[model samples]
Target: MMNRARITRVGALAAASALAIGGLTACQSGGGESSGGDVTITWWHNSTSDPLKSLWADVASEFEADHPGVTVKVEGYQNEELQRTLIPNALRSGGGVDLFQAWGGGEIKDQVAAGYVKDISDAAADTIEAVGPVVSGWQVDGKTYGLPFQYGIEGFWYNTDLFAEAGIDAPPTTLDELYTAIDKLKAAGITPIAVGAGDKWPAAHYWYNFALKSCSPDTLKEAQSQLVFDDPCFVEAGELLQEFIDSEPFQDGFLATSAQQGAGSSAGMLATGKAAMELMGHWNPGVMGGILKDDAGQDDATPPEFLGWFNFPGIDGTAGDPTAALGGGDGFACAQWAPDECVELLEYIESEDVQSRFGEIGAGIPVLPAAASSITDPNLQQVLEGLQSASYVQLWLDTAYGPTVGGAMNDGIVALFGGQGTPEDIVKAMQDAAATL
Candidate 1:
């Protein structure tokens, strides 16, 4: 029988709607070799927030100290920007950063198929085993192309104080209960949900979670690999999302709000108590903590105690299990032509000591089992429990489907949120986009 972690290896989607704006072309065939003497490993990651950002710098410095004649040059970019633009451009250009951020799904598969990423199976075998099967998203045909350092599940991050104000005694566990809570919050003059629809992927997550509840695992798996969406559940997901929209649960002008930007963003809304809840992954606390500030606009030393979480509610009479979940993790992959030290740096990042420190600093939900004990945040602990107990985990839909189809699906979902599209529109868009792939 497979281990618990192995059973939890299910994949999730990523954020990259920019592929629709400007096409993400296939990577070129060949890349230039790294320079010889005085080697430098260029590492790029999406750790723009504090502590984690500084923590990465410290990790790089430590690596350089241990290995003579090598320099680890690290650069950080915002998550959406890095995934949607920088990384895609680098892969197409074929000779840039040595190691860059990767989510390991259809995206990495595209890079691997195009010969843009290296196969690190033999090079980092020990580290791969240590990380365990949660790295499944990073593998293709049993060959490892990247290493996942953080893995987690998605759920609703709520403001407990606000929930009490709205008279919601307990978090909703079913679709009917969720709608009731939304109505109650509205009656109490509160914005029930805060969504960053300006960033298309955030809005797309709504449709994705609904699909997870509506479709069977076998149906979802077939759709991921074959891009087939003939199942009625696909349309059912859109209808469910539309019903939620009809309840007017989200904040006003949500379409203009970014996911994680400033005080006006979705994360900011939750942090500032402007909204009651947000649908986000386990990484929410770290990002939310970074953006939270005092009256003087300086970073707050303490995390918001009002922050709480609950699983996405299950739809009644669905083929999907209520225990099923949707999520994925952050990983890094070496460029095809990066220096040998690139693999070494990957191994170093996943070491027990570093991963434990990563958890201690609240960087993310560490994938290393030994480091699990270091996680003290109750909100993150809730996410960990959900991940461990999930009947089947599904990767983010966009991530599971790759760039072309994923991009189209995101655009289609965003159109629905804007009141310009319908359930059939999203299904048709996906079907059309899949035909190309």
Candidate 2:
């Protein structure tokens, strides 16, 4: 759910005009009304695995039991498929979903502009207040369109046992130490990092972290608002990522490897001890746990142990604060034609009790401040701590910048990884796309 870009004033005005028109058309089409007869709210989410899949179903059933004549139909799809294909197609057609998963940054903004989503500010006001500032990602012009149930920062997830075997005493805190650790891991015949470059977004994350190291929060914000990448740091991010790529630190056939699929995927490699570490969001453990299950779907006896986390190492001469972070969250938004019940469902999911349950199950780092105590996983706790202490948290590049620029930036980054592009190429790709905006 992470991505990139800034938008120009002209582009902003254009988008705003489109949003107003779309909103008007949506209202004219009876967007907020419930069908008079049996009402079925279609919920689309990307939790295609258990226990999250089952947890969501259970929640839906509970909601259905409490409300007569309302049926909740929950559908699950793979993350990439939903994001890159299903949701886009559905939104374009202006149907097919009532409540759908939303990432709450530029993606939501784009959807809002296209008139694919509804503004639930008044309906979810109490929930928004409880969630606090984290909901800003889902707001446009100070109006809420969605509610975040889970949020977290990205970092390296490493195997303590692997680090020990590589003769590393502690997680590296600086870039030099990180490179040293990478060399040491390689010397021990272990893949230093597990990246799913085949899944372009996972590969794009490396460049994003480098940007976080080289650009200050204010500079990033300015770029986001203006859709401009005039700063040298943006290209420097590409250069830094290229240096890492040249180290041959990733798994073999990494360009073809998926990010979170089965045993051959990046998370699978880390879970099954085929690699030393992976750079992923707070959701890594749940994905890894899913991969570690036995044939009968029970937890494996040797499920990943001594799992640890560390912030992305800082470069020595970077302008950005070392403590700044890159991250975002998962939320649900109602389609413009969805019933009022859709908003109710979102509020139900964000309630403190439900969010606490979500934390207890390690679904993700809960967005509810009070649910922080319910988090028991050590690795997730580390992510939570890093997020709370960050000097500033930049939304994922592709997400902050919206689709066009973010997609171009991601393509350019993966091209660099594949040795098909350069740092300048990455910047050029984004600049070119921004121009269109």
Candidate 3:
């Protein structure tokens, strides 16, 4: 996630909003290739923050040290700019990027269809096998295209201290209960929620959760492949989101707030104790820490002691499984023209040792099962527990829906948040966008 503006691999809820970071400079460079036994692998990812950023840099240097005559150039960019603009443009323009951020789902599908990404099924087989079924998001027709390093489910990241102050003894389990908590927070003069509506996806996730609760698992699965919005549950999802917004729980001028900037972003609001909670992905703690550190210009800052989490509240009457979850993870894909070392680098990144450190860093939930013990953070471990206990996990809606439809759907949801659109309008937007495909 661009410093907290743009992303999901449901670690998807991990980053900030892409739209919120308008000045994400594109540091475009050609895929590094040299003759005479010399190789350079250029890697791009959406991690412009600590722990993950330094970790990737160190990994690149380590890889270079391991292989003679090999130089790896690794870089980080804001999530949205890299995913939505830089990466795609680089792929289409050809040869500008080698290894880069890949958020599976429809984005990778479209890339594969356009002959932009390499078929890594045969190349990174062991890494693919190690990550197991989570790799499916990066696959199309049973062929692997990208690999995930961190995978997790979405939930509300709240301030436990604020909960106490508001007299919310326990996190809510149902929609009505969540409303009660919100009302209680308000009674205590606290902003119950912080949403980066300025960044569309953060706000859109409310609808994603609503849809995850409203639609049956099979219907969501079908929608992923068909892009059809005929199901009434989809409409119901929007209605629920509308009702939640009508409750006026978010901080003032939330529509202008970014996701991961400094102290003013939605994540920032939660980080600074200015708001009670935020709905975000597994990478939230790291994002919050990064925001606080950047704000203070410090070497490190950790998630506050008051931070807490709970899965999205269920709607009792909904067709979807109450235990079902919404999620995604950050991943990597090599450009079609990238050299074989690109695959080698991908493998190294997902290697047990590297991924163990990934888990240890508390940046996000490591995807490899063997590295599970490395996840020492209590909160991140809780996310792992949620991922394990989920009756089913739905990939983030925009991601599962792919770029065209997903982009349209996100825009429509954000429009709803801004009071300019309706639930049915989101369905129509998805349909129109899907029609073009």
- Top TM-score prediction, candidate number: 3
lDDT of 3 by residue, 1-437 (tens): 24333333334323333532664444445654654488877788888778789999999999888888888888788777677866775776677678899998888888999888889999888889989999988898999989999999999999999999999999998889999999999999999999998988999999999999999999998998888889999889999999999999999998889898778899989998999999999999998888878885556867777888899988887899999999999999988888888888899999999999999989999899999999989999889999999989999999888888989999999899889888999999999999998
Where does candidate 2 stray beyond 4 Å? 1-37, 294-303
Residue 382 in model 3: lDDT: 88
RMSD of each: 7.4, 7.3, 5.2
Candidate 1 — what's its lDDT?
0.86
Instruction: Give per-residue CA lDDT, model 2, range 101-130, as digits (tens).
Output: 998788888889877889999988889999
The CA lDDT of each predicted structure is 0.86, 0.85, 0.87
The candidate with the higher TM-score, 1 or 3, is 3
lDDT per residue for candidate 1 within 166-248, as digits (tens), equals 99999999989999999999899989999999989999999999999899999999999888999999999999999888888
Candidate 1 stretches with Cα past 4 Å from truth are 1-36, 294-298
Q: How accurate is candidate 2 locally (lDDT)?
A: 0.85
